[model samples]
Target: MDAETLPPHVVRTAPGQYEATLPGGTLRMSMRQEELPLPEICDFALRHNARRRFLFVSRVLGRHMPTRPAAMQDVASRLADKISIDPADGPVLFVGMAETATTLAQTVYAAWCRRGGQGLYIESTRRPTGGPIAFEFVESHSHAMAHLVHLPSPEDDPENLFTTARRVVVVDDEATTGRTALGLVASYAAWRGIAPESLRRELAVLARWMTDAQSTESEFTAFHSLVEGSFEFVETGVFAEAPPAVPHPDRAGLARRGTRHGLSHPQPLPWQLDVSPGHRILVIGTGEYGYQPLLLAADLEARGAIAWVQATTRSPVLPGGAIGHVRSFPALSGERHTEFLYNVPEDHGYDRVLLCCEDVLPPLEHPIHHISRLEVLPLPGTLTS
Candidate 1:
């Protein structure tokens, strides 16, 4: 098999240090594994949050960057290959961190299904429900901190999903400090009235990058990933007010529910992007819902156009190092909030740029300059049907 190519901006700076340049700014990342190249898996980006200074933007996540569906599926498949499922390990429960890795985790569960294995897919969300809250945890570094785990209905055997499972496989796009996972396990420990050290866990981590200070208190039998390493974020002392962000955890929850039970909600305005042969296009999905634009990108790709998909985020990051550049825009909700896209280079422009949002329409002027066409279309249910 031929080795795939890494993005041009991915460069090794020094021993255990690599720089990933995106349009936002260059990120100086620290890695523990010399064998795992940074660019092949992910790139570094600065974070805009007051608590954290940087973000490790994923390339295959099909979230921040536009990627093909097949490629995204391949990543999940590859990650699954690294995990060894033993019948002796007993029944397992797969937990996907909300918003970002929900889909990635679902794909992993799908992989298990292929092997005729059984597992219940559980996800952590910021959304609340009238149902009982299984547990709640905070993603301290994220723009939104509160995450709630609501179990499925009793008819689906929610009790069995938790009690019968001997292990919890937590999945996330990448681990920066690993505190998020720690918080998760800690929350789980409290919910079950079990000691944190007593849980049998296996981290099906995507990017297993952890700093020296990261928590490793685990009963996990295995740690698996397509790549493993860490990055160093150097903040420029640049501070600013971010745009108003809507977690829309409800939409994320609905999508997961829809996928499981074949339910579909009202979609945002149905808009079409006219594509021509050999056009390099970009479709941007707003907030936590990237699945819609992902399907759009797939349609564009099937039509012979080189279509790429990415999403807008409320996370604050400083520019420089790994991120080549940063572009800011008025939040879709209004001027009250600010949104950003990183790693866009001045040199590489697209033919068409399409914006898809779940709830609000963003100002269309800032991100893509000199593009032949720019269209702002509200995603299904985000606007008039």
Candidate 2:
């Protein structure tokens, strides 16, 4: 099979089972929404795990796939529009899930603010911050189970967003069991010594499972997603066990700034490089530092440069299915695991590739520059005071 070939669309493999082929195995997805645009918004990929086998590779997430910054912004803005927060209820708080939803949360948060919504934004992170802790919880099915939320700096939230917030919105790319979001809501309520019912809570996601009424929260928290659906995966072949989770890397000399600690309507870092009109450009983000790269790319697109954005991720996935191409690079942060950048096919024909980083800038002679084939330039991320 050609690596660049997309997976077959949903096909009836049994009486009521519709299956799609993946590099690891076959998956069955049964959706609830009318003519759910699964194929349009996402495609299927395979991940080896006892808990889950299929990965919903989002086409516009700029995580596993290279996507236009405008497309990503439109999808995020639409999701933001769905989130309704009453002003009289008090200040709102937005929590972007770690790793994957970090950029999406920030994009949506920015859109919400542009519409005149007042709030503070923070993202859950796996990195260690030896500062005051806000709350911590677990995503049981995740390869990395534990997640930490850092307490917002008083400078970022002078009005006390967390203490006074009456509405809390947890954003993620997708929700399966919805346990992670609920767990976060519970943890937040407990940390603040407030009843869960007292706060207006919502889960904002691009897609989610709604099987057997699983879409609805058991508590007072509301749910919102672009698509509501259920999926069942029956493995059709034997596969390797998922590799051990990556250990936290040492951030000793890295500049300490970003959403993990807190940022209210984060400003986009300037990209000093000059780009001309009609030149195809791709801005690649490094690990969790995805949102800023996206902001930079969006700015480039606005300035008439042909630009798209994606990120290097630690996720393990097969090369076929939704993933057309994969490039492995040694961990820049000195972590043991290999990092991957996917879906940049040989024919992508981009004039330039900008690899944006927050920690340390690599020399121009790095292997990634050669491996990617395009002119790879290292760009700095957000600036800190």
Candidate 3:
């Protein structure tokens, strides 16, 4: 039976204590909300990280679980609608957190632009561009702690982007402590020599504070989310530190793709996808090179194909709860560490699977090769590896 079909049940992993029977381990999860149902958007999982034992795997994030690009787009559009920053206030700057939120940030930026709000867009990156760094921040609890914000190209921001922006919107999949967003604003504010109070802060997230501890939204000038919730995970056993998915991409081999540096606006790439109605397609992004593939999937979905977006990752999680399937593939950049792709079930009859990457890849050793037809597509602006 699929994990999703399994009822929320608990097991006693310790004496006189019970925990929710999730994928990685036991977790007792609860949620509080106003309008949108939490389960529809997210589910619980146990993480290999000790700093945060529980993980809120988003069903629509196009990360852990494969989701239709249309679904991802809708979530982003709704979140973008909640952002009401006026361009006249000063140029608005939208920042997507590294890794997971890259695509989300792009979508929200595009959606906001559609609403006639002009803004500069950028996403933090774990893989640095050899260019000058704008600033740095940390996601303290994350498996990969360091994140770098790079300088915007001259065309994207003719003037100083950070100093000129009156409002800044940080987009993330979820916000628990909200420290990451707060730290981001702090870093940018300090680096640009502007008072933190002088710049308005905003966050666009799927849910805020997944635990009942306390709301961290107060740190920001405005908080926008589809739902508000809290959860509790009583860990009954210890899991080893999950291995990193793949070794870091070579800095010298870094390929400029998506909005890692900055984009004048969120524009669809020139590439076109041939899609047909009733055809199910899966678009897979190589680690960190996710946003462009999602754009491709979204475009294919618009043209009558059933397209789902998901990416390979370095963060590790056990197979249970929200994560039902796991496949390890060698890094395309020839990194030795094992990279993983999650949640493509065995019986999923996808007509084709597109593995989007920053550089052209040779034949990769992955379990999915036999399950479906696989193709590699280079992300636009990619440098040859």
Q: Say which candidate scores most in lDDT.
A: 2
Give lDDT tens digits, candidate 3, residues 207-291.
8865444566666889888877554655666578664432233363454645777876675664687777878899987776677
For model 2 the TM-score comes to 0.88
Task: Give the number of the best model, judged by TM-score.
Answer: 2
Clashes per candidate (backbone, < 3 Å):
42, 0, 4
Q: Scored by Cα lDDT, where does model 1 land?
A: 0.62
Per-residue alpha-carbon lDDT of candidate 2 for residues 1-385, written as tens digits (9 for 90 to 100)? 1223435644554432346776557677766652235565677788645567788898778999888998789888888898875788788999999878888889999998888888999888766556777888888766666778888888878888878888899999998768788889889999999987888888888887766646446663677777766676667777887776534433343434567777776656656667798888899887777888898898888888989999887777777677788878775444455678888766778887887776655555555666444543444453322
Please write out the lDDT profile of model 1 over residues 296-350, one tens digit for every residue: 7767888889888777665556664445666666544443445666555555487
Candidate 3 Cα lDDT to native: 0.74
Which of 2 and 3 is ahead in lDDT? Answer: 2
Question: Which sections of candidate 2 miss by over 4 Å?
Answer: 1-18, 34-36, 212-216, 246-255, 345-348, 363-366, 373-385
| C-alpha TM-score for every candidate | 0.72, 0.88, 0.87
Better of 1 and 3 by lDDT: 3
